[model samples]
Target: MPRGNPSPKLAITIDPDVHENILAAAAREGMSVSAWMTAAAREALQRRAGLAAVAQWEKQHGRFTTEEMNEARRSVQAQLRTSRTVRRPA
Candidate 1:
């Protein structure tokens, strides 16, 4: 017999409604539940890390002003629009 993949497996418990939602999301994405959950978990961790980094920066500097926050929001929205336009099929 061939050797199996060496990735570690996790056993998790979620509410029934959440479980059903996860199944539907995985099917919609054409991914196995494990793969979908792994992607979701990775995204969450990345977002958490980004927030922590921002907090550290603010500790050294100061809290962002309303105008600065608005500018950042606009910049992110513009980038998202550009990305969507680029992703569209011809």
Candidate 2:
């Protein structure tokens, strides 16, 4: 992994089975166990943040209407289609 991270070390305890699982998963991803844990923790935090933001929005404006949801779906699909790169015949 690229550096520039301030490495602060800490120790924690985990079950042997969980430790083995983490080792296997980290190996599969070609990441150190610490890196895999860091990535997973970051993802978990982001997901929680997104959920909190949506909850706050829903409190301000009631949940989205069906039409609004449909529009969002269409917008995302269009974006996905437009964002794909096309290869040309050489």
Which structure among the candidates has the greatest TM-score?
Answer: 1
Question: Over 4 Å off in model 1, which ranges?
Answer: 1-5, 82-90
Candidate 2 error regions (>4 Å): 1-5, 65-90
Model 1 over residues 1-90: C-alpha lDDT tens digits? 448876688888899999999999888768889888988999899999999999999999999999999999999999988987774321
State the local distance difference test value for candidate 2.
0.84
Model 2 TM: 0.63
Q: Which lDDT tens digits does candidate 2 get at residues 11-31?
A: 989899999999998887688
| Per-residue lDDT value at 86 in model 1 | 77
Worst lDDT run of 10 residues, candidate 1, spans 81-90
